[model samples]
Target chain A: MSQYELAVILGMTAVTFLIRYSFFALGDKVQFPPLVKRALRYVPVAVLTAIVVPMVLLPDGRQWQLDWRNAWLLGALVSAFIAWRFNHLLAAMGGGMAVFFLWRWLLA
Target chain B: MTTTYHPTRHGELLQGARDSLPMLAGAAPFGIIFGTLAGPSGLSLLGAMGMSLFVFAGSSQFIALTLLSGGAGLAVIVFTTFVVNLRHALYSATLLPHVAALGQRWRIPLAFWLTDETFAVVQHRYGAADASPLKHWYHLGSSLAMYGNWIVWTLVGVLLGRSFEGLDKLGLEFAMVATFTGIVVSLLKTRPMVAAAIAAGAVALLARDMPYKLGLLLAALAGVVVGVLLEGRNATEEGQA
Candidate 1:
């Protein structure tokens, strides 16, 4: 591997590992305040939504594609609805991807 | 569903792997796509596999490849990786109470293998109303499954990319969105949780232009604050009623 590539991989590895391991390393040494614990309860929902919303709404990461041509938004909506209704992971993904590919083909 | 039933560690481990099946399905395409694109994005074979093995976080690895392709500097790539993965810190903290009693050896590997899929499944397993002491084994099973799945698929994608063309543009990454949507939807058991999701989505849209993906962090904070405040209000109303 090139020097630059190695550096990039190593840097990413260190940073990602540290972030993931930080709290586990501290363990019971640091007790979170009750308020912090309450906040932590919402982290998964909040973070996942934050990541998913923009990806669906702005697939290009630069512009808002809210129209029908945006297969991502449509597929994600279908996925979310299926998940809410059936609460099945495989169903959500399968239904969503099917819609996404079918929508793209229709558009094309 | 008997109250007296206790699952052995081996059973828990296998159960964890079984529970991760859907997530593995969701992540398979993503890992393969990453493997296919890594080469075109200027990563050597060793570098790409090294990343899948060492970095092990799909989103950050994809982001790093994007930044590298864009000629971003080393520091920029690293900083963005750190910012994007800050969510894992929250995950680790959330699971810490369950794992705090384990030794460093267990904690270290568990932390290393803690991906989005594992966290989604393992956390639910931990939250289940069971007194099984083998829950950690469940976590281990889920982690190893995801880890092995990622490495193997990445290698497959690398080889497949060498033979095929245009696999990266197929929108397979949407699998991740679909999977995450399922996870978040299931987690929305309470009104506050639903409100937090809506709040986070709105704020993330508004703050999409923030540098270094800080918008994600800001959106998550906003959601957490809204959820906590709403929960507190609900508690107070209950007391008054």
Candidate 2:
């Protein structure tokens, strides 16, 4: 590994570990305000949705590919529906990947 | 409502591992895909494994790889990593109450091993009303399972990527989206949660061009604000009614 790559890895590791360990390290010495605690409840849904939306709507990461030909969008929709109905992670991923590959082939 | 069954620490640990099986499955493709891409993206084998071993956060690692491949500087890549993994802070905060009583030795490793998958399963375990004093063992179990699973799959992918071709182009990364979708759907039991998802999605769409992937952070903040406001409004309406 180049020195630059090593530095990047070390920097990323430090930052990530600190973020994960911050609260646990503080333990009972610090407590979030009530509103902050309430807001924490929505973080998972919000952050995951934020990440998923751009990935699905703009698979290319640059353009907006909102159409029938966009297999990612279609597959993600199907995946979301499956997850909502079955609440099963494996089923959702399996079903979604199936749809994604199938739709891509059909379009190709 | 008292039950006669009491699980031992070892039992809780094993149960935690068992419960994380689905998440292990979900994360497998992602880990393998990262390994396959790491080599082609100019990372040495040790560097790639070091990332999986140390960074341990899937999405941030992916983002870091992307930024690196794009010729981004170390500072930019590191800043992006911070932004992408900032959500983990919220996770640790959410889980802090349950783990606060533990010693630093336990907290340190547990915190290090925490990921989205482990958080989902371990948090659920913590939320359960069982009277198990050894729930931290359950957390340890899930953590070790995910950590080991990630390393193994990354090794598999790294080896496979060397001999095989075009594994990254197979669109297997979509598995992550599907898994995250499942998690979000399951977490959407409340109206605020549903609103949070919608608000986050909309803002992400609108803010897609933000530099250093700051859009994700902005979108999440917007969603949280919208959710909190809606929850407050609902509480007021219910009070008046």
Candidate 3:
């Protein structure tokens, strides 16, 4: 690997590890405000949506793929419905994949 | 009310492992895809394995892999992944008081092991009325189980990548999306929660063109701001009433 590539790897390893380790080490020393604490409750839902939305809406470029042929849109709906109806992550996953595959096959 | 069942450390650990199974299954395909993506992206065997072994954060690793392939600089790669993984600070803060009594032995390892999937299960686990000390073991159980799962699945992905060519095209990643959707919906027990998710999705979409995946962070911040403001407003309304 080149120096640049090696540096990127090592940098990632160091930075990510330190960030994950920080609050545990310094948590007691610092206390969060009630406002911040309340907001923290939304972190998971927010972060996950932030990650998942762009994939279904704009998988490729900077625009929404609001078409019927959008596999992600179709599969996400199937997955979201199954996920809600079953309230099971694994089942929702299975249902989503099943729909996604069928959708892809049908499109093909 | 917080002291109902006091499970022994062993039981908590075992329960922790069992509860993590659903998220584990959700993550399985993701791990495999990451492993497979590593090779064609010019990552060496050591690089792929070392990343999973060390960083252990999925989205950041995926981002790093993409940047690596694109010949992005180390600074950019590090900064981007750091922003992506910054949400862990929120996880850490949320978990702080629960694990406060545990010493460094528990704290250090659990900190390293924390992940979105593990936290999804663990935050609720920490709330079991009879939970306190046993919760630490439970944290260990869930985190370590996920740690092992990622490693094993990444290995499987690395191996499978060679033989399976069309896995990405197979739309298998939707499983993770589906799993996340389930987690998101389940957590939306309040109006602020609903607003938070909507704000996040909308902001993420709006900020999609932001460089270095800053859009993700912007979206998260937007959600938190909206949720917090709504929460404060509700508190004031209750006081007035």
Model 2 bad stretches (over 4 Å): A1-6, A63-71, A82-108, B1-15, B18-26, B36-42, B62-77, B128-135, B160-162
Report how far residue B212 has shifted in candidate 3, in Å.
Answer: 3.0
Report the TM-score of candidate 1, chain B only.
0.87
Task: State residue A95's C-alpha deviation in candidate 3, in Å.
Answer: 5.5
lDDT of each: 0.86, 0.83, 0.78
List where candidate 3 sits over 4 angstroms from the true fold.
Answer: A1-7, A59-108, B1-11, B37-42, B70-73, B127-133, B159-161
Pairs of residues at least 3 apart in sequence or in different chains that clash in candidate 2:
none
TM-scores for chain A, candidates in order?
A: 0.82, 0.81, 0.81
Question: What lDDT score goes with residue B184 in model 3?
Answer: 76
Alpha-carbon deviation at B87 in model 1, angstroms: 1.9
The residue-by-residue lDDT of candidate 2 on B136-211, one tens digit each, is 9989989999999999988888888865455556676676677677678878888988999999999999998886
- What is the overall TM-score of model 2 with all chains considered together? 0.81
The parts of candidate 1 lying over 4 Å away from their true place are A2-4, A60-79, A82-108, B1-6, B69-73, B160-163
Candidates ranked by TM-score: 1, 3, 2
For TM-score, candidate 2 versus 3, the one ahead is 3
lDDT of 3 by residue, B78-140 (tens): 998888787787788778877776678878889888888777767766654453566888788
Best by lDDT: 1
Per-residue error for B146 in candidate 2, Å, reads 2.7
Q: What's every prediction's RMSD, in angstroms?
A: 3.4, 4.0, 3.9
Candidate 1, residues B12-129, lDDT tens digits: the string is: 8888887777677667877788888888999988998999999999989888889989899999999989988987888999899899989999999999998877887777677767
Clash tally for model 3: 2
